[model samples]
Target: MKYQDSLQQASDKAAQVKLFLQRTNLAAHPINYAVSYEYISGYNSELCHIIEHKLLAKAPLDDFVMAELYIRFLAPANPQQEQLLQEASSMVSRMAAYSDVAAEQLDNYIQQLDSSMLQIKNLGADTPLLNIVNQLQHSTTEFRLSQQQMQQQLLLANQQSHQLRHELEQLKQQRLLDPLTGLYNRLAMQNQLDIWFSEQPGRRIAAIAVDLDHFSRFNLEYGNTIGDVILSKVARKVSSYVQNSGLPVRSGGEEFLILLPDVDLRSASEIAEQVRRGVEKLRFVSSRTKKTLPKVTISLGVSLYQQTENWYQFLGRTAEVLLLAKQRGRNQVANETMLAT
Candidate 1:
């Protein structure tokens, strides 16, 4: 299902992807080429939409942005996580096998008792000897029953352990996501970035720092409960723009960061503008009072990663850009270029 293009069709798609890369000034790296190929093939509608928007606005795509698109739409699932699950499952299987071996050993012991009982009955002739054989048989039978019961309990314990391990794996996965907005949390964002850098040291990354305009005032005007609703709504709107091209993160309270890999500063700013506009369009009303609330807007700042600086420094620069947007006027998108201006 992943690939349906035949020889001729695949060649044609490859040609178009080459053209797209040339037009957009993107390098023909494997990740970049694959993303372009997907966009040109039109198999991925969401990928096409995001790239089309950038094209319409004449925003250039770079290696960083292309890398991000590849990751969002085409990258394989995390091997480390998969390996962990596989290892855990394997361990449970081994434990279950051990339980089976224990059960088999108990069965062998029961058989031995049966053989001994028959031998004792044959040897007995006196009344006292016969009584001893009866007592021995009863004790052997009770011991056999107890061993079977213990074996059953052991099997049950192994099954429960397997189930518990699976649940723990699920919980570990959920921890990376924000419960409020259904977006990745800060920890997930960091882990993703770390992976990106570890795999490719020169990987380009662009960050869009987003903050709701006059959010504190809005929260003060309405209750925190109402503010939370608005925040969640805004998060949805912002994340929509980044569906498959970037990591939409709920960094902290009332703050979000959209990270696009293989994207240029201009393209990132454009995406940030789209997010700002989208949030501006969301209208909120109090469900209890049936009264409409004031329109919500967001301000954003965009920054491209620098090879000369560390990630923290890059984010700090992004935060600075966001501060500039806030200072100039809320509800606008600012970028590193504007900082120079």
Candidate 2:
């Protein structure tokens, strides 16, 4: 404890000597740095104990701490320990080069350490070993400041990561949401459809294509503003029917695509009929109507997937059949038809 206190207040050399004083204490704790020292042939556990626990030893104790410390700084071969090799080597070299006896040998150790780095790319980027490097980069000549630099870098990295994640979440919201109706836009629709397709196939998948009969005249006569009102009403009314039904997407102006999972042709037709009846019965207020204006009506084309059909082909066939429903009359639901192969 006294030696640790002295080392805490002392210079790097004094701290290093204090480290030797606590050598045997180090043996009790796993050597965080021992693996690297072992690569170059050095372990000062018992010697460390002798220095720290000298009062407890039996006979004349051998001081392996200074010797192993010297070996740690001076040994030439280290292949496995790459992350701390440079900093550990540099710190050890600093200690050894000051010693008159090891000054010439320290140069050879550094040369070998430098050569080892050539085969390895920046491995330090992976571990939190930046503390040691940052210490050297920002440290005063006298103090070992690796741990301090590590703390500053850690906080900065965490803050940057949080900001980046927030930005990414916002971008994802923009990409996945429809700005006008607050529904999922087309891109998001396709993404979800793909995910659904990959998972359990929709128990009963039905695609219905709907077109507003005489919709063009509404835009032309009522003006785009009134037409927008009518469209919003239509979207809301259709969405209401989808309790557990698949999503309803605005495929295009005056047209919508409804995906109903686990619903077959007969059931899908019933749902479409419900939508038609709902729209037919509602009084649409348009063009200065003190009285309730004319009710809007829509034609729907429903298509059910056969075991072999994909969503793309199913949707295409549904649209074609929907055109047929328009030809018969604008206000009716067409029955499900098999996709022509």
Q: If scored against the real structure, what TM-score would every candidate get?
A: 0.56, 0.48
lDDT of 2 by residue, 159-185 (tens): 555555555556556645544444445
Cα lDDT of model 1 by residue, 218-267, tens digit:
99989899999998888888888985758999865678899998898888
lDDT of 2 at 8: 37
lDDT measured at residue 223 in model 1 versus the true structure, 0 to 100: 87
Model 1: pairs clashing at backbone N, Cα or C within 3 Å:
63-262, 64-261, 64-262, 64-263, 65-261, 65-262, 65-263
Question: Least accurate stretch of 10 residues (summed lDDT) in model 1?
Answer: 56-65
Query: TM-score of predicted model 1?
Result: 0.56
- How many steric overlaps are in each model, in order? 7, 4
Question: Where in model 1 is the C-alpha error above 4 Å?
Answer: 1-163
Top lDDT prediction, candidate number: 1
State in Å the error of residue 240, model 2: 0.8
